[model samples]
Target: MKDHVMRLAVGSSARGWRVAIACPRDVYPQDSDSSRYLLEAGVKLIPLSLPGRISPHGDLMAWAGLIRILGRLRPRLVHTHGFKASMVGRMAAATFGVSSGYRPVTICTVHNSIAGQFGSGSRAWNLAKLVEKVLARSTDGVIAVSRALEREYLELSHPSAMLVTCIPNGIALERFISVPPGGGGGVRLPSDVEPPGDAGPPGDVEPPGNAKPPGDLGSPGVLKPGRGPVVGTVARLIPQKGVDVLLRAFPLVREAFPGAELVVAGDGPMRSQLQALAGHLGIGARVAFTGHRNDIPALLRTFDVFVLASLSEGMPVSVIEAMASRVPVVATCTGGIPEVVEDGVSGLLVAPSDPGQLARALIWILSHRDEASRLAQNAFEKVTSRFSIDRMVEDTCLFYQEVFRRKAKQAACES
Candidate 1:
């Protein structure tokens, strides 16, 4: 979510829009990398405490804070991201209008499916749907990051009156596409934010002692000469990401290629549990659990095949990054993944939570170098043509204009 915001905010700012972001100050501390980056990019930071979960007190406080901020800023548009922010932001926009006769063009971006995250028919899902239906009446427009999410919004009872569009998430292609096959110079981070040493947490396993450091790899997917095939993924260690499913499938990958290695990058609450699961599967020594990495471009160069075992996703930027890096992909056919990866063309797809199917896909990619390269190249071309950051930003700004024009016409008709 932070990445999506950073890309959009920076891109929008570059186009000469005076943009400001209202975010939870506690979550992104004053000294955090994101705060520094946004400030450096000339984007204003409005510290608003929006709770992640339901809290009557917190929600009330957030709504009040938004009202105060919106009243002061008096911006022409109030664009919010995710469920919680949308609920509070739209209500504030509506309430602020009643109090001050000023209403901003309110827009919300749905990055993931609420029902998909909290299973359909569940209490949380039902409440979320109800909230979205109510909020749809006030929202001027909505942007779904994938077609799947667009369909979900259209099904809402009140969205018929709202402008809902699918705008796939995009990345800065230049960051990933410029790298050489083996990995050109890694993406540089702010000096204060760069990870120390090899960029893994303490006690994290390093590559084989004889291998070259990650910075000096000779070929894509091979850390050093004589090392085994490397299968890697970058996902938060959470249930929704299905990292456990990847752990179960790794043993099968080792069966076909004994020297195969698995590297799970990124951190979350389930990190310890996943590391233990790898130990239980007896592939502990072969797996590297690097907790939270900022150096994705460099890390991706060490992967023979990139896999996403997510139970759900909304056009995952990680997969696009891998494709942009020219790495072959194997991802689950769930949510917006199928839309991103054409089966057997750009990359292979497997049913979610199916270790056997996932293992087969990984083995096939590793065994068939020619086919994998073709798929990787196809993916690279597709992403370059459709999902560039410039394209997304331009499309978004156009939508903003269309919404404003429609609102103006409606107001004039009433008068």
Candidate 2:
């Protein structure tokens, strides 16, 4: 989500959109990457308190804050991301307009299916559906990051008055593609692209201390080396990501190939629990839990096979990043994953939460080096052709214009 925001803000600002992001102040402190990136990209940062979970008091305060912010900024559009932000932002926009007689068009981007994240009949899921249903009357437009999410939203109780479109997430291909061979090193940005302000060139940025460049993994298509093949994944250690499932699958992977190592990057509430599970499974030494990395492109270069065992995803950026880096992918066939990875052509897709299947996929990728490389190449071509930041930005800007024009037409007709 942070990555999407950063890319979108920068891309929009570069295109002269006068972008401003409203997020929790404490969550993105002055020293945080999100803050630094937005500032560098010349996007205004509005520090608004928004609780991640439901809290009557906190939500009330957040809603009031959003109302104040909306009144002050008087933006032409109030684009919200995430569930909590969308609910609060849309209501605030509507309320602010009623009181001040100046309402901004509201657009909510749905990144994931609520039912997939929270079980279909779960309280959170039901609450999300209810909120979306209620807000549909006021929301001018909706953006789904994946086709699956688009279908989910269409099936949900949204009004026909709203316009919903799918705009798959895209990345700044230069950042991932220019990662120096062998791994851990600064990326070289294209000469045409300049670094923002005094932030310095992105190409000069060095990899983290832990991500050492690895030697060649033997022959072109073989996985045998002095050190075992590295199977890696970058995702928050949360239940939704199904990292535990990956841990359970690792033992089976090790059974087939003893030296196979797993590197789980990114941190969340489940980090300690997942670490313990790795120990209990007796693969403690084999798995390295590097929490929250900034050098993902460099880290990706070290992976022999990239895996995403997510139980659900809305077209994971990590999978795209891995593909862009020309690494073989093994991800679950859930959410919009099948949309990104064509099974057997670009990458391998297995059933989610099935450790046995996950392990088998990982082992197969490890053993069949030639096929994996071919898949990796195919994935690279797909990402290069389809998922570029430029395309996403263009599509988003067009959508914004279309929604704004439609709103204007509706208001004029009513008047």
Pick the lDDT winner. 2
Write the residue-wise lDDT of candidate 1 on 102-206 in tens digits: 888899999888876788899999988888888888888999999988887788644665688899999989888766665722422222142222211122222
RMSD of 2: 9.8
* Model 1 residue 411 CA deviation in Å: 0.8
TM-score of each candidate structure, all chains considered together? 0.88, 0.90
On residues 1-415, what C-alpha lDDT tens digit does candidate 2 reach at each position? 8778778889999999998888887755898887888889899888888888889999999999999888788999999988888889999999999999998999999988788877899898888888889999899999999999999998986569878999999998998899865585232221113221121111211211121212332233544334567789999888999999999999877776666678898999999999899999998877878887889999899888999999888879999999999999988989999999988778888888899888877776776676678889999999999999999989999999999889889889999
TM-score of 2: 0.90
Model 2 residue 89 lDDT score: 90
CA deviation > 4 Å runs, candidate 1: 26-33, 184-224
lDDT per model, in order?
0.81, 0.83
